[model samples]
Target: MNIIQNPDSTSLKRTIEQGTADQRIAVLDIINEVRKNGDAAIKAYTEKLDRVSLRSFLVTEEEVEQAYKEINEELLTIIQEAACNIRDFHSRQKRESWMTTQENGTILGQKYTPLDAVGLYVPGGLAAYPSSVLMNVIPAQVAGVKRIVIASPPQENGYLPAGVLVAARELGIREIYKMGGAQAIAGLAYGTETIEKVDKITGPGNIYVALAKREVFGHVSIDMIAGPSEIVVLADDTAKAAEVAADLLSQAEHDERASSVLVTTSLSLAREVKKEVYKQLEPLPKSVIARSSIESYGAIYVTDTLDHAIDIVNELAPEHLEIMTEDPMSLLGRIRHAGAIFLGRYSSEPIGDYFAGPNHVLPTNGTARFSSPLNVDDFMKKSSIISYSQQAMLENGRKVAAFARLEGLEAHARAVELRLEDL
Candidate 1:
């Protein structure tokens, strides 16, 4: 990992600006081809990229049952428990339609409604992420989405991972498809012969999937155009270098494009953690990926003060921020942006990704600036409802008519005036 000081280095800034106009437009170009050619184009891309020939894109119910049966009892139990926790937590976020009635016979309220159906594009890159399956589907289930669909690439043996099937089943999501990448997203957006079009699509994928979501936005709602995984640790003199190194490596092992950074005021600890990262990297199963990610995007920035460390964190707006410092809670109110915050040395990024009750489907790159982690609200809609009685219209009709006339909307003014005449 490269070590540097604050504010001047361009590593984080360049990451935000990495994707260019040509790369972006090329993604859109691929999406347009997929939309025009539909399943045929998707099959071609699957063969071109994944080097896999598909017998069928859709998986049968019997296949899901087989996968469930094949999954180990222990892993199944874990998925069930995680799903329960996720469901229990997100259930708290469920909101209902409500109205307020006034003495003047006027009623106003915002009604919450669940999207009828949603598609989940599960990425088959690096590894099959069962935790992501839980994060994406559980909230939609909690929001009462009637039908939930999932699309993932098949293994070389023409099989979906047993863990993924088990996770889907645990969340009451029955529809499963053996499709992935931008093609899967395209299939979800524009309904294929076998796949039903969805109101929204949620889940993480490669750059292709991200671009496909961006292209299909007007056709169907999407979670966000997520970037590579990243985590930033803000530790102090009180923190442990080894623990910090392990946490950083957890995110680094995700992909070659992933980033793991440590911001601290302790120069000695920064050096210690940098050494620990190399020691830990040697033993990691995905050592090559982790090494590449760290070498390319990792950093250790030493600040003169803790407050200065925080300023850098806010500027980065990392997907995951860990405060492995003394009195971690004291700085909670100071952070303005982060997809998820893990406090203290014991807390790590993967905790939120797997067993933690919080959603792990967070906004990547610097999107923590505005976008939020996937939540129950992603699967719901809010409607504004207003009803006015004759008396209520008569009481305030002139203000309404005058306001419309001020905008030169004479027809809108007349519509309100004609109703007031009944008074």
Candidate 2:
């Protein structure tokens, strides 16, 4: 990791902005083809991109049963436990419809309704994340989503990952599709013969999947167009260099474009953490990817003060922020922009990613500045409830009509006037 002395804010901003125009164009073409040709286009892209011609897109019940037997009992136990933790955490975020009534015979409220069906895109092949299955599916389940299906790329052997299948089965999700990429997204947005159109699509994927989500956003609700994973560790002299280095590498190993940064007040700690990162990278199985990420996007900014460090963190609005100072909680109130926060040295980023109750699907590419982590609310919709008695309408209708007339909307004015005339 390179050490910089007070880097410029613009340079920091540039690291998180990802995706290319050509990539967008390619994804658009794939989406258009899938929209026009439907199931045939999905098969062609799956064969061409994933190198496997799938006979059937849906996973059978027998296959799901075999997946349970294929994985060991020990792993299954862990997945179940993790699912419970995720469910318990998200259950707290569930909301109920509320109403307020007035003596004037008017009622106003908001109704919370779960989405009818949702599509989950899980990346398969080399990238297999069963944790993602738990994180994305459980929230939808808590929100009472009726139909949930997963679309993952099939391997060269034309089978889904046993871990992913096992996780989905644990959540009672049966509809697993053997498809991926932009075509899978297209199929989900505009249904094919095999796949049903979903109201919303969630989970993370590569650039093509991200761009496809961007294209089909209006047609179907999407969680967010997630970028590469990123982590920013705000450490002080009290922080252990080795622990900070490990946390940074955890995110860096996710992808070659992943950004790992350390903003600290202590120059000595920054230098030590830099050396520790190099030592830890050598032993990692994904050292090449981590090394590439660290060299290109990772950096250690040694600020003159802790306040300055916090300022830089807010400016970056990282997906994950770790406060490794004397009192990590003391800084929590000051952190205005972060997808998820790890309070102390022990609260590693992976805890939230895997076993911890909180959702790991977070906003990336500085989206934490305005957006938020994926939750039960993402799978739910809200409708405004309005009811007016005859007396209420008789008192308010003329005012509403006059306002509509002022806006030159005669149709809106007449609608209110008609109700008023009946009253």
Best by lDDT: 2
**Model 1 TM-score?**
0.95
Best by TM-score: 2
Per-candidate TM equals 0.95, 0.97
lDDT of 2 at 372: 94
Clashes (backbone N, CA, C under 3 Å), per candidate, total 0, 0
Candidate 1, residues 297-410, lDDT tens digits: the string is 899998898888898899889899999888999999999989999998778777788887889888877889898989999999999999998788888899999999999999
lDDT (C-alpha) at residue 52 in model 2: 93
